[model samples]
Target: MLEVRRRGLTTLLGGTAVGWALAAHAQVPEKIPRLCFLTFDPGTLTSNRFGAFFEGLRDLGYANGQTISIDYLSVEGNGERFPALAEECLRLKADIIAVSTTPGAQAAIAATRTIPIIMIGLGDPVRTGLVGNLARPSGNITGLSLMVPEVATKRLGLLKDAIPGISQVLVLSYLADPIAPLQVKAMQEAAQPLGLTLQVHDIRTANDLPAAFDAAAREHAEALLTTSESIFVAQGQRVTELAARYKLPAMYCFSNDVVDFGGLMAYDVNYSRVIRRAASYVDRILKGAKVSDLPIEQPIKFEFSINLKAAKALGLTIPPGVLAIADKVIE
Candidate 1:
């Protein structure tokens, strides 16, 4: 009878231990956070921009495949596909949806109200109606603003400085972009004070590019300025080539790649830095911080890059003042 009781007690104790271990295992929360990254450009995920974002996550103790999973979706400049892509993310039950452009953010906002969205490098969240206010977004959307309208004036001023004698300036922009009209208006207002003739050449499609350049040449345009649209960005090489062919001194926003492709200059926000900063928002949101509580951020640092080679090719001398203030001068 003593042996039987001892065996039964041992068996009960072992069962209890097993049950406790199982309970502990079940209590361990899943550590992996799933992210859905949406962009207008299909190449964004592989570009240095998203690479910076990934690096930022790594800095915050999040690994892409191990601690987190990222789903990349790109519209490839097709705004029509945004809604479908956003819906797909929702169907996958993504923990967070990160968007880079205005259209993509808008789609994400329309797709679902519950899924958190981090808007990166957007022009103006409030003006675009992506958020209620900058200080308090009051919704799921909040991240960094590129300040495109404010910067548009600065870019126009820089172009004027680069080509002081340039009387006829052509503004190349995408007509469909929501921020394009604001930028064009800013350029128009800034041009009045500078005593410059600003002509608007809207490119509705890639095929419209050659005609736009022809129009610029026909108008005797002395310089060119472009809006920061994903279509233009994706066609950076072609734009730079056309500028070179026409010998038009061009100023672009948000792309040093254009300068590398032999374009004249670019003054825009530090894209990589903004994207890295966006990761912090993701980190906070993942940690149970409310999106409305996190204030929208504006880029504090801007990059001014000039290619001396391109400037020399155009036979235009960059002002010493402009060159001195440039953050990066590529030879």
Candidate 2:
């Protein structure tokens, strides 16, 4: 009976060890997917445009630090640093790299053809050589493209309507932006039919802003316009303040939030919608959707907003027709 008890005890101990090993294996946590958000939107993860992206991800059952982890690396509107940042993301083994500019996308693509890239709210991606086809991208690059020429036509025509006798307009743009030439060309084409001339100033940095404004004043420019870019987005307040100081009724691009920055008028892509769409793209990519399978998208939503207070400060009256067409009017 003692021998029988010993054998039974051994069998029980062996079963207990096997159960413990199984329990430990079951407790192991699964690896979470990681994403890297690159480029600039005023250097904050909480920037309104970026917030829209995260909100989209949350709606799709993603939570930061839970199902997915994200690292926001802002290059502060400098594209030269994009490659290094892309390398860092590669080192982190990021599942996706989302960029805000065409140059940023280029950098990521150049860094690795294997990793996926999403470009957000940039000019014609095809013209920029980021992709061969929109319906079906050939490589690992895809996202949203803003129709630059169309936006230019709309902005110039609206500016003409909003500001009477606005023959000469000042344009402040970042010279290093990949799409700067395209923006200039589009604006020039748009201006020709309106009988307006564009006086463009290259604003390379913050210090260049004052000089650009002074040049505009010296050139007798009646109004101001700016290309949508990360640099301008970063300096939205400063640009609006200078426009106010110069009494230059301005029309802006990119986001209507600039109107809140004291800008007179803004006609822009609904970046929130575009970026939120991007979140769906991100989700699809995480779920094994190939970049080549997703087509580059265009901006479906646009916003035209006017700040009545800004117009009043400039001693200008907006036309009833213009106000009627606006999506938002800030009093």
Candidate 3:
């Protein structure tokens, strides 16, 4: 009798343990959501914007191999490769697609209308016709915008401030990017008021960058302002080196100019903040929130970063007032 009582107690404890295990497993879903990330700039998985965004995802309770799995594909400055990459992501049947810039977004949208598409660090989505409007993006696409037209003018103004005698401003842009034309228009409008000669140059490939800089120098551009596209950001070091080599005062639209060893002043959106905000969007979507219902967001925190070291190298003195207002001054 004693032996039977002991056996019965053991059986009851084993059954309770099994029941608890089943309940826990039921709470945690079996299949993890797979997210696909496509970028125009091909950089290492540990660095650059994509890496930062990946880290952001982990902070939001979605770590790779745990809750969410990511399939990352990069085009590495090849526009032609975007379509094929987008198609591959769709073929994987990604739960959500995260893309950078206008071209990448278009490719993802074309690949699948049903899957939610999130864009990071893109210019005016409405003007580019990526979405219907900012307040109500009535589609599967919604994310962040960098506030282009106004931001363009501010970059020029900052360049002028850096170089006081700046009579000519050279603008470097990517022709294929839809935001380029709008940025150019804003730069022209700002130039008219300041009496600054605006020389716009189009660059399609990385090899063309040196020649474009040479042209800007030959034109006697007193200052330079480059756009914040993936192409230029990918080649941040090269662009900054050239700008310093030419001794031309250059302002960029990203912190990479200062942090990644390039350019002088960057009056642009706070990128980490943008990526963190993107994580929030991703989290909401994963929790069954509609992408269309999550209204697209614009950056509220813009950063002004100045490299005093780069400024000294170029023989330019940064105005004290600008330094006073700068969010970061790299000595």
Candidate 4:
């Protein structure tokens, strides 16, 4: 009878050990990292603009919803919504916040001091106080700089080249975007050397766009140059239509804007490439790298795209010199 009791006790002990092992296994949490993407452009989540980011993450062995999760918040051209959207990301306990544009970066920085922020396509982070310096951010923010001034100069040069004898140019900028003033200054500086006159027209909302176009017409602007602001990019189709309606040849910042949206020409960094590089920052941060250690990067390449159909619609001829150097020409 003692032997029987001993065997029963052994069995109970073995069962308890197995249960404990299972419980311990259940308690071991999965180490899936969470990323929050904050953008002023609403179409980022749904369009190919942000798809490049996911593709980059995949290249780094991170598959969304499987190995990692992403929470997206877009203000959709409403600058006032940025702070609240950033707070929402904080409430969700995001491990890292990836911000696109200066306004989104500003909102994210204001929302959390502990969470790491990866800024993409920001203009003059140092001037805007988003970072101490490009080499060492010294805070929880670092990624890619759009190098807005250089790009603006290049775009204006292309515009001058495409439309020789074009004297007056209208700059359509969003007044709400912090980067707008800097971009306008860069354009003005670029215009002076080329003997091109630039008139600044600030649009505060989508409703203000029509009035800005009317102002452009009243100024007798020869060509239109739109800033690379989220609000302006979000209204690309409208801007293109208005430029056509006003009979003004327009130059855009992104090649896709010209190739896809029917703008006259564009000279800027390939946004897809920049966003892809930004994903590397995310990967490093997830692997326990500090934001301050990761230095800010700038685009190594810029592309020029021209729409032949758009030029035709504007009754303009593309100089052979311009067409010869274009990376992409859409007919």
Candidate 5:
């Protein structure tokens, strides 16, 4: 009888160990939340934009596989694919959709009213009807905006001041871009007061850029100013290359392109800050703070960057006044 009791006790202990292991496994989260990243630009995992965002998420106690998984999609500068991509993310039942541009934001908004949508560097969300207001987004969409209109005006003035004798300025922009019309308006309004004539050229594709530069040259444009739009951002290297190849004194809106691709000067909002700021909104949503409760944040960090090499290539001199104010100067 004592031997029988010992065998029964061993069997009981074995069953208890198995049950405890199963319970422990069950207690842990079986399914991680899935995030969908949709962008009009080429969406590589290594893109600095995503890296910064992931770092921000890590700070919030969630890492890949442990808490969440991100499924990314890129349009590769093709607007036609955005709608389909957005719809697919919705069909995949993403917990949240993070979009990088206005077009992508609009696509996500149209795809679902239920899913929380976080925008990155969208231009004029209020004007575009992406959100009702900054303080209260009032919808499933909320995030950071691109440069303010007044900031755009100020950058143009600085460009003219830095490039003395720049009376006629060539403005490069995309006609189909969501920010183009507003930028053109700002350029026109700002140029008129400065006595600068704005020669606008619409570059719908890469092939059209050379012709646009030729037109700017034929018109005797003394300087060039490129606007910040999603397509232009994706083609930053190409834009800087064309500006150099054409030898037009140019200023870009993004410091990344200016520093990386050698533009003479750049004044714009800090992109990493924009991405990191959006991470806060994502955190709030996950913590049961409704997106509606979160206010759409504006850019608090702005920067001015100058490239001395590019300035020398155009035979332009960076004024001491501008140099003193620059946040970064690239040699």
Candidate 6:
């Protein structure tokens, strides 16, 4: 009887040990997915683009360091650092990569074909050779495009309408942006029909801006027109200060960046929508959606904003016709 009891106890202990082992295995946590947001401008942290993305993540049941690990990476306005920044993302074992600028997108593409990349508001992805086509972005990269080249003519017209006889206009293009040359070309082409002379100067950094303005003055540019580059967006206030000093009427890419910063005017696509939509793409990719399956998105909403106060500062009057059409007018 004693021997039989000992054997039964040993068998029960063995079963309990097996159960505990299985329970521990089941309790093992899954690896958290990682994301990297690479960009050229770090100043956009307080901008609408940044707010929309993080807010979207929160709405999608994601909390940083809990459900997902996100690294907000920026080159601090240095395009040359894109490759290094992208490599850093790879080192972090990022499952998904998001880029706000074209250079960032290019670097990410160069870094990895397998890692899915989400691009936000590229001017012309097709022309830039970022992907094969929008419909079937087969390999890895995909996101929102504003098709900025299409609006080149319209932006010029708005500036001309706001300040008549703007024959000589300074085309403030940031060549460091990679896509700025194409944008400058579009503006040059658009200038032909309007009888406007474009003084295209490459603005590489904020320090170079004073020289660019000097070029504008030398070329006899009446008004300043900037491409949809983040450099200008980041340096809007400073640009406007220079414009104000020279009494140079200016038109920019975003409404708040212009009217809010005491600048002339802006006609642009809805950037917040494009940014938030990009965030949605990130969420989808993290949830096991293939980049190839996700189609590229285009913006439908556009905004034309004017600032009567800034116009007053420059001693210019916004035409009644132009003011009537403006979506947002700051007085």
Q: Which residue pairs of candidate 6 clash?
A: none
lDDT of 3 at 169: 80
Q: Encode model 2's per-residue lDDT on 108-170: one tens digit a residue.
A: 888889888888767878887888989998788888888875686688889999876889999
Off by over 4 Å in 5: 1-29
lDDT of 5 by residue, 1-331 (tens): 9999999998999999999999999898777777888987675666744577777888987687778888878987777788999999978889998988777888888889989999877778887778888998977988888755667787899987887677998888775757677888988998988889999888766778889889988999888887777667777787788888888878887776557668788888877767877777777887777888778878777898888988888888888998999998887
> Where does candidate 5 have its weakest 10-residue lDDT segment?
41-50
The TM-score obtained by model 6 is 0.91
| Candidate topping TM-score | 2
Instruction: In candidate 1, list every pair of residues with a backbone clash.
Output: none
Ranking by lDDT: 1, 4, 2, 6, 3, 5
Q: After superposition, how far is residue 297 of candidate 5 from its true place, in Å?
A: 0.8
In the range 1-331, model 6's lDDT, one tens digit per residue, is 9899999999999999999999999999878888898987674445434777777787887788889888889888888899999999999999999888888898999999999999888887888889889998868999988887777678888887777777999888888766788778888888878889888888888999999888777787899888887888778889989999888998887665667878788888767667877878988888889888988988887999888888887788788999898899899
Local distance difference test scores for all models? 0.86, 0.85, 0.83, 0.85, 0.81, 0.84
Give a tens-digit lDDT track for model 4, residues 218-323: 8889998888887766788888898888989988876665566778888878888888889999999999999888999988888898999989998999999999
Name the weakest run of 10 consecutive residues (lDDT summed) in model 6. Answer: 41-50
For each candidate in turn, the TM-score is: 0.89, 0.92, 0.88, 0.91, 0.89, 0.91
CA lDDT for candidate 2: 0.85
Cα-based lDDT at residue 90, candidate 4: 85
Candidate 2: residue 258 lDDT (0-100): 85
Select the stronger candidate by TM-score from 2 and 4: 2
TM-score of 2: 0.92
Comparing candidate 1 with candidate 3, which one achieves the higher TM-score? 1
